[model samples]
Target: MLQMANYEFIRKQHILLGKPIRQISRETGYSRQVIRKALKSTKIPVYQLSKPKPKPVIDSVQPIILEWLRQDEQAPPKQRHTATRIYQRLVDEYGFTGGESTVRRYVRQLRVSPPKAFVPLDFPPGKFAQFDWGEVTVLLQGKQVKVQVFCMRCTYSRKIFVKTFFHQKQESLLQGHVDAFEFFGAVPQTVTYDNLTTAVKKVLEGKNRVEQERFVQLRAHYLFESHFCDPGKGHQKGQVENLVKFVQKQFFTPVPCVSSLEELNYFLLEKCISYETTTVPRSSLTVGEAFEQEQQTMLPLPPQPLDCCRVVSVKSNTLSMIHFEKNAYSVPVSYASTELTCKVFAERVEVYHGNKLIAEHERCLESGKELLQYDHYLDL
Candidate 1:
């Protein structure tokens, strides 16, 4: 376990300073898992030295009281002695004169700590944002497949963006933000997250973070702050946390029968925008109305959207195919046995041979799947 000081640093950096875990890890040299462990604990994990209390009154009776309680551990829950019963028994048997309240207090200490309360939070207009991913089951091609729902919501205005992806990848992470920001027509000042692997590479002590290189590039492009909720502390980002559940229940309760993620996401976008007319708690204005007000405070959208895609070079086989991320895509036959470039966009893959476009195919998410364009084979 990390010392309380280290835990405090993770919380401050991740939750307050809006630093990503990767930045923390690079700065502190602590593993992301360790950082998360420290974050899960709300209280600092400091070991305080217990000062000896002047318990001369209970000193002699302490052993007797312990033995009785230890034996009672075997008794039925109903039959176990209550505090009053124990105090009476002490006076009748061993003649303990300690106050009943004192005995009751000691007994309480032996029990497990009480459950923590969920803290309530609200955001000021255009000040905060939240991002999270939730899984939903969809019926595609007569098979039930799980898909990732990337959700981003403006905390104050309740404006949101919902998109679906076949998997969660770093590219998808950046793309989700780009789409969300474009949808909202502005960028939020700070965005909160849980320790999502795409953006965070490590968790470090206090205000220090090691963010993913690509993530850092995305941050630099849009210039929004990144905040991470404590590990297991979803309540810190409770709005999106609840939104995750809400998306599943409200949008996906009836399993969506769709041919592709794009179709389902189109449906989700409508649902997202529909929330605009609903009134938020303690507010007279609709969600859309609040968003309209918050829009004035937002940072203007960039002139050109960031191209958040992953580009890589791969050697094409004799069959004019190249494998990437466990899936195979094809290029023109003339490019066979040569090094071809693949630009992986959010929804499609573009194959290029020396800057000339050879082929384009819709990206596939299923593992070990191959997409072949008949035009590429037509030359043969």
Candidate 2:
């Protein structure tokens, strides 16, 4: 069989370079007839025909195999059977004698369409939203750091709220919901989430989830229903999942640099709000227009927002700094060698001495990081 490269080279040399066929044969090493054939053809060389493999065993079990593959459309991607597993099933259940490679080869040719059809989803205003977290890298104070970005998307408006946190712990998760609700100016009636550890304490059968206590508190306070996707089925909350990447790509691209995480998040929030004016997919209206309709159906904000702060009292070290979660923040030098109360909020840390606020510093996300407020101390 003539190889493709020789044919390509021959065609290129003869047709494009205006080289004669005898010279082409001398340079390419081909018969005149083969060269003539190559010159006449515009298409690439391909095998004339493929003979079907003989599969006596597979012939009997082919029906069974197709049924299982068809049923796999509904199975979770991880739980679906592999070619080897399917072969095993055929051998065990149907008493079929077939080589695993044959089964694998046949299965490779098999495919089923997605179980769910692609269709437009319409959400009633304020009726639905999606929440999720995405990992993003940012340069904070000249140090590169990884942070979790919490994303919430209103299903109706496609309006979004984005916040970044060093940890996806309960405190950050709850605080994200609190802040997002405050930003949206209303709470969605229903929120969808994958079985995120910060929200789900235990996964029950089917779509049931025993949510974390803090997550439950958030739901109760906001009076919104919480929905969890089936195991390995995050597509149910695809809106926020895409928004998570949207936040990372469109918002975090060029790798945002900021003096503090708080500053970076403020920039992201502005970007999120600005997205409202942009047109939504498959809809003629802008996100702001959709959200405006949603706002009417969305539940009203609570009289008081949840206390999303985590407060702890720590004794100030000789350096007049208090430590929390491996990060240290300085208070007034007078607080050195004294016990002070430190209240840690999502974006800042407040230090108090005997019920008097002494110092406040931007929250730090890294271990062994030190935050010192300029007004807290005067160097000797």
Candidate 3:
């Protein structure tokens, strides 16, 4: 075979080089008929054809395997069933008598679509802060549990603020930002966030975005703009992502537990301050100190703290009441059941009757349901 290939190569060169095939045959001491055939054929050497391998019985199960794969693809990644589990299920539920190898081959053929690329970003100083939530599992009162930690980082300063909460619902999410802004003592000109449902209602193309009404009010209160990264492009806020992992390692590595979320957040804030102190001590600058300097450049806090509470009219026909989130308060019984405005701050609620203070009460705690006793409104 090697010799035949070499002869074919030389014959082609002779023909292209304008040498006569008969003279080349004579010089090479080869048969005139063989040389004539090679020149006339003008075809590359055709290797012997190997027989096709027989299709295994697994090929028959391709349809079933593909159907399973499609179903898995449509399911959430966290909830999607695994291949081995799916194979066992097929055997038990569908009475699939196929061999394991067949199932494995089909599963290997399934491919997941690649995530979109991160959009390039150029962050300006005091311009953007990236926010995210991370879940950390810890032993609470000897019971294993998970807590959501809110993480925020300034893109330029690299300063970070972390706070833990029981849930990531809208109230907690908005409250986290308010607390973070207060902790930094400033608000970024433009804040960046993931496509969290709490903040963003819908994301449109051409950098247009729609935000939840409450979140929009939150933004307006702070006088800062909002931007969201393309879905799944977390690297757009890589600083905060690293900050989340850094907190996990520095604070949660040993799985420390405390009596309450407030206690955990207190310690986490202290640790963050300590870490920032060590980062640039020679310059005598801490993260807090740098943030204080940055605050000078930031937009001043609104004339008042942002109102994070929601307003709901109390359902009473006689006695007027106002509901601020989960807790309810009673106002003048005169405006009862009528729609009245309520102003809620971090720690207090002010019930108004057309710009008149009808009632005021400290926000209630989980145990203090009767904070606003209706009888107290008798004098009003």
Q: What would the per-residue lDDT of candidate 1 be over residues 231-350, giving only the tens digit for each residue?
A: 777777878888899999999999989987778888988998898988876789899999998988888888998988888989999988999889988887888899888888867888
TM-score leader: 1
Better of 2 and 3 by lDDT: 2
- The per-residue C-alpha lDDT of model 1 at residue 52 equals 66
TM-score of 2: 0.65
TM-score of each: 0.69, 0.65, 0.57
The list of candidate 2 runs beyond 4 A from truth reads: 1-104, 110-119, 141-143, 205-210, 257-259, 313-323, 327-341, 352-359, 368-380
lDDT of 2 by residue, 113-184 (tens): 457677778787789999888998888998998998888999888999999888887788889999999999
> RMSD to native for every prediction?
22.9, 11.5, 10.4
